[model samples]
Target: MIPVIKKRIYLGLLAATMLLFAGALGYIWLTFFQQDGGWLRYITIVAVVAVLACLIVIGLGFAGIVLSLVSEKNITFLNKPMNFTFSLLYPVVMWLGKVFKITQDKIQRSFVEVNNQLVKAKQGKLTPDRLLILLPHCLQERECPNRITTNTENCTRCGRCPVGDLLPLSERYGVHLRIATGGTLAREAVKKLRPRAIVAVACERDLTSGILDCIPLPVLGVTNDRPHGPCFNTYVDPDAVEKAILFFIQGGEGNVFHVSAN
Candidate 1:
């Protein structure tokens, strides 16, 4: 699910650019009027107005973020806009952090943490059928020959992979579960399934991107565990997955399923 916020962000950026251009023109007009020493007051007023307009655009973005944090009912509408604001602001924030020599990883982690809180705030509105559990193909054992991507029922419950437990959990909860290889397949699955909410498992990068892509759709991201290395033989805590699932299913109240990794 590519973020629906892309077009919105593009439009916002376009508007900001126009405002900046107007501000520059106003500044130039003000400078020329100062040299001519006539009608300089009008040019100065125009420049101040243009600068204030630019500041208002920036202020609206920050306001969106703050409202997203404080207002739970508005989460459905505000989340995507807030994500767009973050996308626009993140690079600048990172650059300033770098200039100060602050750690980028910490900054990213903080962003993810805040994103998660916003997601959780909206989860209370979801039901079981509207929620989906999205898994990564890397969660499967490398040596396994089964292709669970097309049909999870193909899994033999071999106990070697978390899919063994996940299969039953999905069936028990009556939730749609799909294993996707990459963003394209994941987007396709999301499109076909048409779920209102999603619980996604991946690395921090994938989780962050997927969350952004699936804006306005509440998504709780759980980072997978990589014991051997990245991509190959990656794992996730089944309890964590189950908890996330139940958070939407049971309105954030359910017993944690004890998962056994045999």
Candidate 2:
């Protein structure tokens, strides 16, 4: 939902930053070669080299993003480099997006999409026991008295919310399932369970941040539906969750449980 004007502004600023660096490098080179200096020439050369190296890395990172979007085949080699670059650049990109008055939700959705691409590029698979289904507490109905954060078995399977359906899904798939109220609890669950892979459900912001936080863990993020509001009475497509689980379990072999990039 980012405005076209804001996106243009951000791109303009990014281009300007790149040009500024290039200009600085050019000035350093000119100073190093044109002047008959000793240590200063060495210093300028080192600075120019460093700047050139940074520009090359940034170029590669952007190229990875483009390849992930256009290339149909798996580019597994780009996974780690793209993730590392994205993690390092996200804050600055977000700041510029904000300065340009871009929509926060749009930025977050883009982040999630990039994260998803990076994860898919990894092409990793895990067994049911090594997979974890991490659910946000908001998926629970506000009126429901069940406290399934500690023990999901406390649910009565009343079908009032996703929790009821998720419980059976976890059991059927034999994957670890836990409900976390916040990032702290989610991290704790991840630390304790130590699953090789994760299927996480949350809002756009949380999902984006969580995916970034759990890099190299191969998390498939499934966004939740917010019917009532942002946090309360939120719901997730149980089928989407199932498909994500099956994706890791089955390794994207057949279309029986195919998961889209939603």
Candidate 3:
């Protein structure tokens, strides 16, 4: 299946859920207001109107996100609000996906795909030094005695895993490269480096959560391949990582991965 198809499915589910919720509210207003109790009726009307207003704002934010996916130029104004809307609606979307029996990983991967498009739409050129490449600890060979989590530079350039290949890319591009053992370490690395943008490599779950956690900071996620199992010995495409790096530093030019809502 096309990767973006899942994202479109997610969006469709979200829209259907919102429509159903609004229909329920309308049904309540129509059924309850007919009895006419006085102040209670007024209060109910006010509450329903407020909820509808909130939904309208959410709908507008959703539209902005859809627009960003198709737009080639960065829509700078909607960046923060779109991030906030994604954070707000993610749980609801996940629940909806569960109702429809969609695997959470599929939904998460879809979310990441949509998010990458949104980030690409809003991201501008940055100095290479301001870009950070975050790698999962699993990228290192499982048996390697060296622990690169503390310091990625500890790797002796041994070609045991993708880490060795990535290290040279970092050096060549003059970008900050760090290995994160988990979410906590990833957050800490972001805090310490304070990068303008990030190119992250991880599984679907981690990448989705990490993107949401780092609000307003553009991150292009490259999902890793789990050949052996979950986290034991994962691998990521070094070419995807390089393209993501170039996308940020060159502002959506030069072999950047492109996805659209269309």
Candidate 4:
């Protein structure tokens, strides 16, 4: 199995563990209140039942996500619910990772991987004009005087940064590529362009956040490599970006293009 799929299975297990842990605590609470009979007991029962129902829904959502990962296509009806459940569970999963002494980046990267798979499973044909390649501003050389945040076309193709390569590729593909300095600007670009699909590149944290934030919007995330450290002169494979572009532009039909696990 692919590493990302394994991580997703592990993530699903973690969510199940969280539910079991909650159930255990609830059981202990009920045991402590066994001797009491009053409105408090009724409230406790209601709360426990409610929690149980939520757990059931979340479990189904996890199953949906897992099934989508293994299947060729996403279950159209479950997509929104799965994404919503993921959004609800993300923070809790991060906390669980901490309890288990797992690095946040690892979990975030796993989340991105699973998200990418889900998005890819839902892939459909899109005109190049309707596609967007959203990139983080950190991909730019820090020392460069030119700022391409507001307008990527301002880039002079100096070859010092990935943007130099990406710009020409975007032009060749006739897709809109925008470099965003932060989340606010990124959202603005999304809002203004209203692309049907997006190919986003960023670190684990931002990519995870962006995936959650752009729920119901297909986003194929390619994690950037942070060589110098967090957010400084990060690098992404331009070829990966192209593959993502092809995945969408070609409608991802019949193995014409494959979304890589990297």
Expressed as tens digits, the lDDT of each residue in 190-224 for candidate 3 is 99989999999999999999998987788899999
lDDT of 1 by residue, 1-262 (tens): 3222422333333344445555666667566655755577676667767766545555565556555555533445444446656665556565655765757655555556656656655535465778889999999999999989988988999889888877787777788899999999999989998998899998877886787788767788888888898898898888788888877876754344554433
Instruction: For candidate 3, give the lDDT of residue 183.
Output: 94
Residue 136, candidate 4: Cα error in Å is 1.0
- Per-candidate total of colliding backbone pairs: 2, 0, 0, 0
TM-score of each: 0.71, 0.82, 0.89, 0.89
lDDT of each: 0.70, 0.75, 0.82, 0.81
Runs with alpha carbons beyond 4 Å of true place in candidate 1: 1-81, 97-105, 253-262
Candidate number with greatest lDDT: 3
Error of 1 at 149 (Å): 1.2
Model 4's TM-score against the true structure = 0.89
Off by over 4 Å in 3: 1-6, 255-262
- Tens-digit lDDT track for model 2 on 120-196? 55554688999999999998889988788988878888878878877888888789998999999999989999999
Candidate 4 — what's its lDDT?
A: 0.81
Q: Can you give the lDDT of residue 246 in candidate 1? A: 77
True-vs-predicted CA distance for residue 261, candidate 2, Å: 21
